[model samples]
Target chain A: MKRSFYLKIFLFVVLLFSSALADAAEVYYLGGPQGSSQEAAVNPSYSLKQRFQDLFSSLSSIRKDPEASGSISGHLSQTVVHNDIGGNREKSYLKPGVNYITDLNFSIQEKLHADYNFTGQWFLRKTDDPRVESRRDVRLKQVDLQVANERNLYQFGDFYGSFSQFVLGSSLEGFNMDINPTDDQHYQIVIARRNEADTVANSFQRNVFGFKADRYLFKGSDLFSDFRIGVQAASSQDDSASLPDNHTAKDLRNTVFGLDGEIVFKQGLSIQYEYAGSAYVEDEDASEKTTTYANAFRFQPSMRLGKANVRYLYYYAQPKFYTDAGSSMSDKIQNQVSLDYRFSDRVNVTVSENYYWDHLKGSSRTKRTFNDEKYMTWNLLPLASRRSFNLRPYVNYQVRNSDDPGNSAESTTLTGGFDISDRLNAHTNWGVGYECRSFIDRVTRSNSEIFHRIRFNWAQDMMLWARRLYYAITPNVDIRHRKGNDNKDVTVGAGFNVQYDLFQRVFLRMGNTLADTNSASPSGDYVNNRGFWEVDFLVDKERSAHFIIRGERNNYTAENGAQSYKEQRVIAKFEVNF
Target chain B: MRTKTIIAVLLTSMIVVGCRAVTGAVVDRRAVAQESLFSLAGTLIKDLFDNYQDFSMESFRAKVAVDFVSSRNDLVNNAASNIRAAKVLDIDFSLDQVLSDKDLLMVDLKWQKRTRPYDSSNVVLTEGFTQAVFKNVAGQWLLYQINKDNPF
Candidate 1:
């Protein structure tokens, strides 16, 4: 009985959203002057006749100089896939099935008057697959209708609404409007549904309403090239009526108010700041409800000094601060700074530091943890230079500490890597890289580990018999050593890939990889091989077909036991676009 | 188990029917072939720019991989902010080089953009060089990553 109630609510919401489509249809029908004469005769009203004649005259004018443009384009595709697994039913990864899919996109733009225009867009998709649930068979992904002029714009249906990072930023489906009455002033308002009710997930539908206003100044001043200030407000709530009886999520209500500003100077310096306060209630419909009021703020500044660029950031958020439509890291205070300096055209360096901590309220029962990270990068030659030789090296170090009575544990980690590439010629290139990482437990020295890795890559391009061919090979090795057990493990792997134009209309691509691992632990010792081959045939610009085959095998030899498994798959697909 | 068996039989029969239809069809030998891989990769980049200029978020979303990774770790928010910021007045790009490895392609390019902020009348010009990675997902090339900087 409860299920039926939820279903009714869901249907009602669907119908409510569908009203946008219905309105669009009505507009088109009423404007086309193609309505049946029988309706006019039945009405027999003078006003109806006069309206019909007016529409006819308007249609005649449109036919003379339409100033209208539209397009319809998309693709239809069919695919068949088969998968076979051996020795490991639990390891089956891919779903095997046949699928038929269709995608259609249409849009129309017409100039309604001197400085106004009407635009409409529709996107639809259909997928048929017996292996999947039926609920995903067809979907109307996005639809939008807009009426805009030089000073104002209004949108109905789906749109992405954003105000500020900490106030409201999310994709919504409903109505949105932007009013720009002058060059220095702007206003925006949005009312939309954030999420639809999900029966499988047992989650209630969510809705949001928001508005923002901005004022700009000092647009041409030398000291301040641009300065802007804005204020924003947003409220979001979950529909308790749409919640299923067995729902697993709490009904939430949240509202946020924010203020933000930005300043840009003529000397290549800029600063931005934002602050938001939120009031939230969880399980609003329940007797025992939880409520909280909190605030969050962020400040960022960047400057260019000589040949160096510097940037700094500071952020803080209370533990209970929450915004349903925005992003924030709660219960933490963070500070970060970075510098990028160019010594010369061929050399550059970057350095940065970050520090953050949680448990800002200082709860007695909870431990407060702090983290610090430092990083640096130096480049001998930039990658985009495409020089004969390019070298890049970087290092990172981190420290974590906690303040607790009996468990005051601390740890530190250091990591470093370097990459060097050489271009032998226009058609050939080779690169090599190495990395090392070490972790230490300051309180317990026994709990420590060190890891090292090395990799090499080579690529070549050629034209053989007037056909283009390209291939690449990469090999890598990794070693991990632990202090407690005095155990060391190593893994070695190599991969090769090749692409060739077999014919004017056909292309072939294939790749294979092999890996072997020797470990102190029995379960980790294994040898693996994987490969795939693909062929693509192009019938024309709008038609194509693809066939692919893949296979993988794994063998494990350890003191405990020996095991093996194999998997294979084949896929064929054809697609046409119109 | 009964449903699985029925679905298997239906799929097999459909495959058989499809094969017969394909065998009966005729091929057109004079039709134009697809463009080269290099040209195709370049065209994909151009299409990305056009979509951004036109503010076509749906088309832009279609060109991105489902498993896309970003250095900033916030693709959705970053994309939304970019889309809401300004209107592109002019754009110029050059594909400096391309590297192909089976199902993956790496492209290096330099681009310049001129944009007017939504609330201001002044135009801002910015230029940079970046590398982008594309992966072949079901015969469609989708953007996987932007190594250094993301213009959009």
Candidate 2:
């Protein structure tokens, strides 16, 4: 009864808020239109007939809903540079060996009712390499489909579970992820050195797929709920070729299964229990088949008083691994207790302490994994009374263990940040922290460090014929001090950006950034100083056509007392969205 | 230095015209006003029950310094005798929400009662009006739309 009461209150408040929003403003303000040169009135109720006509005239509306609709776009870039170092002049050309990048997406959403809806999207991309690629080439990007349903499946305590929409389920909607392009190459291989006639046709294919889905059952209740769940499983596989004798391939497969249930008591409190397990297989060693699994459970109790909301969550997960040696397990526990409190109208404070513990097996090892379990308390305070001026202060503290060693290692740090005037801004953050650790045979070392960063920035808008240009200057200083080592670095950077509309459908932009670091290592050169410049020209005509041309130059100082090296590149692309 | 100055001047001119700075303020003010009204209206409706007794449209009209004349549902002998009469004396109204440019006003009306409703126990009949209008002197919203049984 108490749980339901809370649910009613929650729904009532949401309803009130929505109505308030609607009656307060006839239409929502979401900024300017696409490629708009000026901000204009986007009133939805300006004219009901006109609004409907605009909607009907949209490209998406004309295409009609289908099982899927997507497109693929790719571009190519080339760079040629001449290097004159040590009196030796040489020219090197860099371009894509096989540049092909494409993205194909499709979605199908069948309307069930006015109140109940189901949607899904299928997303895929092909690329050659993600880390580094020529303007024209890409790598095995991604491919995945997702589906979701609302009020269409089973409902548990305030949760829903659907089995038919897991990851790659029939519902493919709302799939958004970054992807690189893909390039494919076909070749013929000789099965036998002497049997040229016995050649076999070969093709290289690389693809990555990621998806997320949940089957919610017995959901939307305040108390006592159960769910059957599955997901696309976060997994990836890659195969790439370099020079001869340099081939790398990887295959990772994962299948996830889970069940969850929740119980809401009469006191407006609830506890949720979830037991999920996954089987992950990777192509690493044939002799050793690796398997990893995890189970987690969380409990949350919440209360709302007027405009203030208070809630707490307690979560625990035990991850287990199986290897050829035997079965081993570890307990990873994260305990976070925080209160999100609002003070007045302009101040928000989030104070919380997080304790993470990763204990392997039953042994109490002094040194944990790469990131050891520690007790940390973080404080964030933000004050934004207006859009022009903002201030945020943060502090962090980590508890020290006896096994840790460092010189002058303190476990506390305090930092402050501030931003002023939309045009001019300044920020500074400083922290003092220490680390203590024990080495072999009970020998301990403690280290103390102080870090500080200060920067000031200024920017202003410039008017160009039917365009806007912006310029900014920033000066930065970084200071670090250890028990015995001290370092101080100062950098002055300037950047300029200009965007102009040459025609109704054409726009041009030029930007440049130059930063010069003036700190010399005990021995010598400031190798970190860099300069970059880029310009882009774009022509856009609604859904009809878009053309883009961009060129960039990067320059860096050499560390070996040699002349600086620079690389320049240019690219052009065209796209049509309908 | 001279070239930089010229470029700056040219850039500034271009931005001011391209962004339509002249019209930006007009659009922004309207949006801000609309948003403020929305938030305020939401708060008032959520707490309307608390002010039901004192919220009256007739009194609100009077408080706005507007004279009102009402025709009762029951009459006797075509005279003022046995006829329910309502006259707004003093009202204090605040526009809690206003949408459609300055056209529609979501008002929170507070006024005194001259003739009480027969069913005084029913809050809906006593203080049912939460929204009003100033579209015109006569065609203005005088009755609460919540009472759909009568459209007057």
Candidate 3:
């Protein structure tokens, strides 16, 4: 063994010397070096400097070439976690076990020929745990690629496509293209899977296709600063056969078309409108599948005048309207208006009202409900000195009325709150808030209730032993009273946190919260405590290490018995970026 | 002589009017450019809020960076719960400040929102100022980070 080791050492030395000799030859061929050719040949120190200079110059030359330049940046993280639970294991949110997780993410960008650029992103995650399925233990979360120029872009693998709110808006694993044919024309096309495939369960998948186009008019006109009109269409179908079982598949088929327009004037007025129509089939494979047709529209206008701003919105959707990729509420009509004004540099006010109704088709079994909401807020400095303190006060009220022949009902809610804060010094500050709320039910008096809540907080930053230390303390209380039984409930909570710079490169943070509640009902009574401490070490600009410990305990006293649980977890993580 | 004087006056008037017209056109062009940029930023921000309000995770994910980090730990779980628990009723915002770098845009704005929690009957009003950073990737601005508080 000794002989072999010595032989290896000798071979390594010989190889190293050979490489150095080759480098010296290259320097000689480059005219003996830069800045001092004679000295570089005679003096070893000067020759070393010249070699480094040459190396840097070549590297810089590579960087200067735009087409040859590329960047690779990424981060790697490894984490180990442990969790423990005691008392009523069924009530615990997480399993008791040890887990090891590794995450890797990176991005690459390169400039190609013909003024085109290429970008690629990749993400990978792995976790080891007995309860986790093997297929899920290791996963490729995302992989995306793109090639783009000034006016056009092409993407594949995984991309996010958004054409319009009511037509097509979602992320998909697909191919997408965006083309700007002229300064005033734009178009987009997308074809992709709407949902990720579940190979383990053999779940169904949705396939979607979308197209959109827009044209701009009066771009630079003083009367109409920006005017644009657009049209979008989308279609999706669920593959029932994709899932072997097919029991949970919806087998849905949907198609939507939309038209939208927007106009902005130089005089600080803007208006936007959109209309959409949809055809949907809930169960495509069923024997008597029925198709539904519905429509929806939205109109919004806003204006700015002097120190005031006003906005209005109107929205309506038919009962059967449905779009999986967009936000649409069916059988509804809504109208909203708001105004904001600035009285001075130190004071501002805003008021808004919203009215909405549901069950527009008036189905016999479904109750039609109307909701009205009003809100007002004020921001004020209150004090004569603008820097002394700040105050914000707000009020909100809402009413709901339901009509159902003989079972009509109405409810109202009012909430008022104020928040006050002040800075005592450069390193200390404090804030306090109070809120009162009341809910009244005309038909069901038993459901009426009132709530009062108060909160206080203080924060301080100090220099202790020439290091920075910061801490905050918060305490709050909430009380509730029910009208029918005169029952009362109360909850008190407190939280404290401290952060200190333990060393030049190390940071320490610890925080805990405690809450106790006493309610009329046994199920609502509980004591909860949670605490956590974390330490972070900055190894360098591109590397970091973190250690975190967390614990939680909850004690519940119910009518039947006491259900309690305690959990503790520890995690250690190291991350590096390149 | 009188005819020559009249001709000189007409020439001077034309020169002054032409200069004014050119100056006006230049100013208008600059204003239009500025307005377009602001409009673009405004639309992006509005779209983000709409997605948040709708609780569309896929659409929201597309607007943010892949390696997005937050000051609050467990950003993924917290974001999910926050979205599920709150129903946004109304939102108002003003984009008064925007700073541009090579591929990054930083926006500072004041905003107000009215929201109702799933378990609560009362609507809560909140107002604050926040700063958001967006990076241009393939001609699209993706949210990089937020300072102060995250609304979504």
Give the per-residue lDDT digits (tens) of candidate 2, residues A416-452: 3332324133332222222222111112222343444
- TM-score per candidate, in order? 0.68, 0.45, 0.70
Arranged by DockQ with the best first, the candidates are 3, 1, 2
Give DockQ per model, in order: 0.02, 0.02, 0.02
DockQ score of the complex predicted as candidate 2: 0.02
Query: Of models 2 and 3, which has the larger lDDT?
Result: 3
How far residue A577's Cα lies from its native spot in candidate 2, in Å, is 2.0
lDDT order, best first, reads 3, 1, 2
Per-residue lDDT of B99 in model 1: 44
Per-residue error (Å), model 1, residue B42:
16
Model 2 clash number: 66
Q: What DockQ does model 3 achieve?
A: 0.02
State model 3's lDDT: 0.64
Q: Mark the regions of model 2 whose C-alpha exceeds 4 Å error after superposition.
A: A1-257, A261-273, A277-308, A319-330, A363-388, A400-416, A419-448, A459-462, A470-475, A527-540, A562-564, B1-152
The parts of candidate 3 lying over 4 Å away from their true place are A1-68, A129-136, A196-203, A245-248, A362-365, A406-409, A543-561, B1-152
**Which residue pairs in candidate 3 collide?**
none
Model 3 sits at a Cα RMSD from the real structure of 20.2
